[model samples]
Target: SIASPWPLLGPGQSTQLIFGPSMDAAKLEEARMLLNGMDYSSQDEDGDTILHIYTAKGLRECAFAAAEKLRDLGRLDAKEHKGKTALLVAVTANQPEIVQDLLSLGADINACDVKGQTALHLAAHYGFPGVLQAILSGRPNVNLEARNFEGMTPLHCAAISHSVTTKALSATGLTDVHLQAKANEKLSCVQMLLNAGASLLSQEIKSNKTLLHLAVKEGNIDLVRYLLRIPLPNVKDFVNMKAHGHTALHMAAGLHGNPYQEEILQLLLSRGADPSIRNLENDQPAHLLQSGHQGEQVRLAARCTPPRGLSCVGKTQCIIYPATRIPAK
Candidate 1:
């Protein structure tokens, strides 16, 4: 149903636009004429309309033409099945020129989809700063906390993508009237926000995760160091503290093939992370080491090697070679 009324649409006010096996232009034209005669602004099943269909299908010409028609009908702001206006779809598709065209036709930039996300939110969520810039320049409600299914705001979205390091992303941060978030790991943009006094420990909406967990999961030692320098979060902090009551060290072990295990271990130990911290099985980091080469490495790390002066060749700390060098008496 996501791609519906393809190549044709039928008249008679039916919300059912998805007819399988392709449609005919003559049929679509007849339907369009009916809708035009009825002064109907748009049609959709549930809420998807021609604009959504065109944007999703990348039918650029059709979409552009439909947008113009919507403008003519003064339905440029008309929402489809889920309160998703045409403009939101264009931004999500990364068609900036289309977005500009829609905006020029007075498509509502502040129009919210079913999830209460605006064009600006969608643009940011998709990491299209050009689209986001177009939306923000209009100076819509920056304080509007438009949420999605996850109840996350646009600032929350900004925390997870590359835009964190981009000037385009930074530009939008200036206009967030709510000053809602202070950090996000995915986008890495939260540092700038925090640097501007965006609050290093602002609360997350759904999860208990903090910047510590985010850094640990991402394995960004620099971020970990930065966070450690700030507050030194504990199990009580916002990040995940359950499962093993683990800290960043525990998380590092779970990280795949931790090449810098030694370095990370040293840092954590220096920072007061307890090496004897046990898991649910009551196993410490030492106990987690298995036998063989890995065991040897772990033993070496823990300074558990045999005494150097007396060697039983890894079996014993002291070895006497059967008195081979003993007296000839």
Candidate 2:
């Protein structure tokens, strides 16, 4: 019959049914029933039970049914080939209901996959604030500082995610702290991790870049501002820290045409960033400005405020120049 894909299967052997999302409710039931009638512990090569596949595919009904069967069978924590649990799959699939169900069934909330990423990392990276909150509320001991293979905590992932929402910013009463954060900004994940005790001092295992460096490189102006405002232990190290022989200001200076780059440069400067700092190429932040198209803007900004006394002479008068248009490229 179609159900018997594995002939000559031993009693200890595991197998799986290949089902599709297009399968109707009736066909799905039939597939589940057929599998239930056979080995109760059947799994695919990746060690995924039918439950893992259903959760991964966002098949809530199928996943629920499989979870019900597996929970009673004491297989709720079964690991796939990569050590991923059904709970992890549900988080990755954005299936919040399934995630809650698995958690209610006593699934290990802090379970790490092969890459050492927990559900928190996935939720943060995907910007699922609700799911992240659910996980945190359910498991208070869940390590907020768990580093994935890339040496990134949930905080790092939140910084890198473009979809991250700032619901936590309001919930944690941090709205007033991040004044520079735009209205309805998608940086609440950073606030969430910080409130949950994620470390700001943590660096990527490979790049040695701090959260500030990543934020600047990604052009996340709000995040850069938020990090700059953090008190205690001094964020000055992050502002001036060198990565690959370049400071965060050095990276910001090169992003000339970015509309926010000017504001970011100003923020960095106001936070005590030294423009004189040079990179490996012996390039100062001002020297890294792009030429041709952005040269005029950079030059004007560089000239706007001269050294405290260089151009003032004995007079306190500051010269104001008329705005001139730079010829288009």
Candidate maximizing TM-score: 2
* Model 2 TM-score, 2 decimals: 0.67
For model 2, where is the 10-residue window of minimal lDDT? 314-323
Model 2 regions lying over 4 Å from their true place: 1-39, 57-74, 163-186, 229-233, 302-329
In the range 79-173, model 2's lDDT, one tens digit per residue, is 99888899998888877667876787788888989989999898888766556655765356788888898888887887877323333443455
Clash totals in order: 8, 2
Assess every candidate by TM-score. 0.45, 0.67
Task: Assess the local accuracy of residue 162 in candidate 1 as a C-alpha lDDT between 0 and 100.
Answer: 31
**Total backbone clashes of candidate 2, pairs 3 or more residues apart or in separate chains:** 2
- Candidate 1 lDDT, tens digit per residue, 81-128? 667777887877766556765776677766788787877567655556
lDDT of each: 0.51, 0.68
